[model samples]
Target: MPRLFLLAAVLAATTAIAAPDNPPVPLPKPPQADRTPAAGPPVPAEKPKEKQAPAAPEPEKEKETAAPAEPPPPPPPPVETEDRAAFEACTAELKSLGAAFRTLPRIDDGNGCGIDKPVAMTRLSAEVAIEPEVTARCETLLQLAHMTRDLIEPAARLGLPDMGRLKAVHQASGYVCRKRNGAETGKISEHARGNAVDISALEFEKGPVPMKIAASEAPDLAAAFQRTLNAAACLYFTTVLSPGSDDAHRDHMHLDVMKRTGGYRYCR
Candidate 1:
């Protein structure tokens, strides 16, 4: 008990204790360095954005100028039924029939007179050669060839057996840019468009027979042969103006591919 009393008296006399209301004083601030910049005056409140008039619409920017619309594209060219290629389906027929021919450059004489795909035909088959060669569209020459092989030659063999195998065909005109019947102008002739052929005579190994021969003067068999040949031509051609049809075509057979409805044909 005496020791405990002595320890309590020692703790009460220590100087670490202080009165409850008293506190220590703060220390002074240190001196600033010489190189330190003094604080600047308060920035003048930013002047409230200096209210000014709105900028003039940026000068309307030239309205970005409409960029001139490109001129409308040109129109497409007109299409025609005869515009098929030079040797389309007819090429196979030409080869099969043993024809000698070559494609020609386009013939455009303007004013609706032209052949888009022309051909120069020298012969139809071994049995028949086109004297002077025919310059017309492939379709036109093909028609003539088919007629020669299937009709004319066969007719000659049967009608004029004395004449050796029909050797050649003498053409009057193939492609001529003139009016019908050589008139000044009424309507353009099929020859002008490379769509017609004119056969003036038939040459055989024995001799030649002119187309303009009068029926009365011609031998009975020859007259009959001409009539049959002319009739058969209608089956292959759209127009057939055979000998004696008219004075204009008396010296030749004027055959053409004249388009018509329902496969119409005019065979005189």
Candidate 2:
């Protein structure tokens, strides 16, 4: 009986230990719409390329569309003046006069006076007071004065009364025997060739007034005279000096064709 009880106890203990050792496993389930598979790491998808078309050629645009190229800038117009024809004619005549005197050999008056002796030409005539010592082309000198008158007359007609009434012109001194100055002698002055004229101002009804005297006493008349004479000189003379200059010249208006295209003008 003791042996039977021991065997039964041993079997009971083994069964109890085995029962707690492992639980029963459940059966596999069928796939369902809502069920998901076991997941792994995610991977990236590749991008697709687009098809390309051929490039087209471009045509040139017309010049009209390109800012018109600025029209190449029109040339400047020529200068116009009222006395263009007469002025040009006088200039040509004056040129001829110059050619005649350019070749005359310079002759020195042998009196230790360093002055050139001028040759007198019989061609020009004069009406102004002439210094006996100086000689000049008479015809050319007269022509210059006449041309000056023509220029002044037209301007005078414009009702600039102060320029004087285009009165008779009187050339006081032209060709003179003196040197350019009383001191050291040099080339003969324009007076030597009668290429220059000293106008004793203008002849107003008040008599021939000197430039210096008029500037202080009659400013309007003086200004008009100076302006008109200067304008006339531009057409006739290359050089024009007036009493308005310094003490070197305070007596008369001196006019000469020494320059070519430009000369000094005065208004006093």
Candidate 3:
């Protein structure tokens, strides 16, 4: 009877401790995934500032600046009426002399004469009357002629020695009114437009340079003529070649406006 009582107590204890067969409550449904993104503790709005030492001052910012403006370009110079009139008159005169010359606009040498500063006669209309191919060059030659005459005639006014002393001043070899080299080739020479003149020898009252015995031996007369020609050449022509230059130049003095370029002068 005591053993029976012990077994009944044991059975009661086991029944009281045994788990139920029903499933768990399901955790109260969580809060639905659509209603809440996560299951975490709520975050504070503003973080609490911690007490600390004082901070150093920051440097000031520099102000931005604007760039400077560029200067304006200058204006063109006024044309000279006097120069235009003079050129017109000269052109008319040349037309009467059988020259087929024409007047054209002058191109600036790009020296900034108008842009940098103003000046009278800023441009020139060169006289060109050569063949069609070299017409422009021929007009330049005509202008060279005028320039040459301007130089030589002044010397005569200054009481310089007359060329009459030379053997063939006007008659030794007449002006060909032709090109540079021989007369056969159509290729134009510097002389075609009166830019150059040839003098095989000079004539004087005494006789031609060849006929005069002492004159041929003396260098003064020849030297004087050469000096005069060269001086005039410097004023009018960009290039000047004489008998002394080379064998090709042994016959005549060749002069041309081969230089006055880009406002640079080359006279020799």
Candidate 4:
């Protein structure tokens, strides 16, 4: 029995020693640290944009327009008078005598001497022309026309054969608004009243022939003719002033028909 027990214990010890070695069990891993989500792909670092300059403003355009037209000048003022009938009668008489004339309105010179029925004589008659025009009274113009046709033309023809006919009489002075003898303060002149005329030259078919009142300057024939003309003018005109009269009469013959208290005629 003892031998049998010893054999059994020996068999158990041998069985334990003959078994293979087993692997050790692994320990559980600590909970992993909280994971952070990865940021989306890194955005490329943005470069700073450059600042641009502002554009310049455009210039304003000018408008095209025409300027307004200017107004016209005013007309001349008319003369005032009340003697229309007398003026019309005088104008008609002048026309009837074949004298070319125009009636002028009254000229009030602010002084005493101003004609009421003045006539501007363009021609004495169809054959006779008044050069440089003459403004005179109706009575004076009529007398002048008669004298020119009768005495002046015939006398001129005798002297100058080439003077086919008397074309014009060059007048030095006519109706003038001035004092006597051109004095500033005095009685008004006959010229101012359109009652006087000054003859300076005579126009013929050829040309103009200036009257030389100085006897020394005139030719022998011309001197005699001038003397004759002066004498004839004295017969027609109440006042006749020639070269020998005064320095004022040295260049022209001044003639007028001024009535005197006595029938006294002044001729020089």
Candidate 5:
């Protein structure tokens, strides 16, 4: 019995000795939220693009326009019409009187001294010739003719018996373009308007008798005839300027039909 128990103990001890020596190691645990790593440098934000302004529009062209029209002119004066009629009538009368005359055009000096219609008288009547020809207005020529027929011839028969028949009238000046008394400036002379005559002499059938305004030193009959004619001229002429009037009229007799304001006669 003892031996058998001893054998059982020895078998249990051998079985223990036959087992492995090394043991297995255990795995690590997972990371928690509080134990995470820190964040890196932050990335820079991107910059926005700049906006641009719009351009201005071009100006429009101006429109074309038309201009206005001008007005008409005025008519002529009434006095001019009347003067024209009077001049025409005078020309007709001259034709009827058998006076040898020619119609001349208007004479204007552009200084307010002018004749509208003038006549160059060649003869006073059929028998009486105007020596050197007298250029004057129709009215002035008519007056000259009337004086020759009515007064001069009849008076010559009495005062100038030696040369009783009339032949021609010697005119020194007619239709002269000058101011009064040949002055440079003043009222226009009647001669400028063909309204005056400067009688220098009278040609008779026998001979020519030169007119001397201051005839105190001349022959008795000649002086008497000149004086008589000088006095008679005032009856027909509106103005009669003889030698004694002024130095300007020393040689010849100045006769005109210038109108006066009060039917006054200017005989000097």
Candidate 6:
């Protein structure tokens, strides 16, 4: 105990001598850490709460997207007009062939039926009269003229030799604006476009005779004439429907200038 008292007095004397001007200050204790984490369940170590920098504020009112432009409209359909050069040329040719025709107003029954330039055919020639007249395009009459002048007249002289010269041709249909075979619905007929003619009967110096009777009874002469007419019509027209071709054409001959692809001619 005496030794400890003496050591203490010596430490005080040394401290006093070392710091005579200033007294020694006591140091403060540091705070202890609570290493024991949250109570309840053990939480995953909160990664040292990362010190994050503040972010820029977002816009309040949203911007709208732009709209796309509209597409262009389609073009109009082609107009149905007569070709001045073609019409004039056809008329000139028809006049030379002894045809009596007058240019008529346009015939447009809409619904896919129209004739740009049509003609009223009074007669093909003096002898080959168009009984009751007919309305057709120039091309049709031209084809008829070619068939009658070259084929019909010659065939009549030889086949119908007993009946005398053919006086006139009785037409049944031309430019009537009806469907094929006169159906309620189907492909538009060639006659609707002024491209066809239906011959119902033929006239001789003797008198008029229905084609049906002439075709069967006069099988030797008159029937030969009908056959010749049908066969020869195919040469001039792209389509020719005769008595035996189908039920629709059994009574009258249907001839048309309807152009087919590859210059194909339909003879039936």
lDDT by residue (tens digit), candidate 3, 202-246? 334444442111222445654554556655665665666655565
- Stronger candidate by lDDT (2 vs 4): 4
lDDT of 1 by residue, 131-225 (tens): 99889988888998999988988899888899988889999899877778889746778888888999998999899988864465666888889
Q: What lDDT tens digits, residue by residue, belong to model 5 across residues 1-268? A: 9999999999999978986586446666666778866567987877776665666666766666666655543321111112777878887777676779998777766555567787898988887889898898888888888888888898889888989589999899989777899897566788887779988888999988876665566768767777887788999899998756688887788999887999899897
List candidate 6 stretches off by more than 4 Å. 1-80, 213-219
lDDT of 2 by residue, 133-187 (tens): 2344433454554554466456554535544444444556765545453334455
Clashing pairs in 1: none
The backbone clash count of each candidate, in order, is 0, 18, 10, 0, 0, 0
> Candidate 2: where is the Cα deviation over 4 Å?
1-135, 156-166, 204-206, 213-222, 259-268
TM for every model, in the order presented, reads: 0.67, 0.41, 0.33, 0.63, 0.65, 0.67
lDDT of 6 by residue, 141-168 (tens): 8888888889988888898777778788
lDDT score at residue 34, model 5, on the 0-100 scale: 82
Clashing pairs in 6: none
Candidate no. 6 TM-score: 0.67
Query: All candidates' lDDT scores?
Result: 0.82, 0.50, 0.43, 0.77, 0.80, 0.81
Residue 112, model 1: lDDT of 64
Candidate achieving higher lDDT, 1 or 5: 1
Better structure of 1 and 3 per lDDT: 1
By lDDT, who's the top model here?
1
lDDT of 4 by residue, 24-101 (tens): 678986666785665898999889988878777777666766787766544322222436776677667667768898
Cα RMSD (angstroms) for every candidate in the order listed = 21.4, 16.0, 16.6, 17.1, 18.5, 13.7
Query: What is candidate 6's CA lDDT for residue 129?
Result: 86
Of candidates 6 and 3, the better by lDDT: 6
